[model samples]
Target: MLKKLFGLTASFAALVGLPAGAWAQTAKDADPAIWVVKDADTTIYLFGTVHVLKPGLSWFDEGVKAAFDKSDEVVLEMIEPDAATMQGVIIKAGLSMTGPGLSEKLPKESLPALAVAAKDLGMPESALERFEPWLAAMMSAMAPLSKYC
Candidate 1:
């Protein structure tokens, strides 16, 4: 009885722990496009990817497998950084320091809109003001999408 209960509990946990949208689409059915360039001495292939995948998506099938087998290297848009290097980058990017703040630097006319938007998202305007506009915008855009991964 204990063993059966343990097995059921394990299965439940595994199902719950899977990423959201894990069963949305299989690679075989999803038509992702790839660009290829080939010549006598060189071959290049480019494919867009979401950078994460569910466990069962057989994406590297047949043609992709062949191309990967022939390729000497795979290049990614951004290499994964180690923890220390990432921390150093965050510090260098001015995220760690408390300065004059993002409100002061923004044109006086924009502050109200910024505050309203921040409030709508359940974030304090000051929390976002520390980062540059581009970074702040990117973070806001990514907030919803981050949960899936």
Candidate 2:
């Protein structure tokens, strides 16, 4: 399973035109985890993902690449919204217009962590207060990953 996953990763890297030696280490040096579930008519491969990773970490190889090549479909969990539409949606759904702000709604103990995270993201705590809790949490989680991308 690991070998198959390596092949898939290698295939993706190769497809994207990365130089063979550009990665920090060869795929043989890495052992990424992969799992397969098979049923009567379908099979699923599951692998862990960090969503964003710094460049130069190589774990793709021929085995995984072969499995990837033979696969009929690939699924991804993301949606790309147009900038204006996305902004409108965020404003409509992610903002707290008249009620209590985020800090007021959050548990007292969580406020300090929220403040720290907001600061780390270079956002003022007040700015985060304008967001609904779910949006604020999502932003807090994703903001720190921007530097890696």
Q: Could you tell me which 10 consecutive residues in candidate 2 have the lowest summed lDDT?
A: 9-18
Best candidate per TM-score, number? 2
Give TM-scores for every candidate, taking all chains together and pairing residue i with residue i: 0.56, 0.62
The per-model lDDT (C-alpha) reads 0.55, 0.59
User: After best superposition, candidate 2 residue 54: deviation in angstroms?
Assistant: 1.0
- Model 1 per-residue lDDT tens digits across residues 83-121: 445434543563424666777777899888777756644
C-alpha lDDT of residue 131 in model 2: 71
Q: How many clashes in each candidate? A: 0, 7
Give lDDT for model 1.
0.55
- Write one digit per residue (lDDT tens) for candidate 2, span 1-100: 3343233223322322323335466334344556788999987776554434445566565655665676788775545355445555655787767889
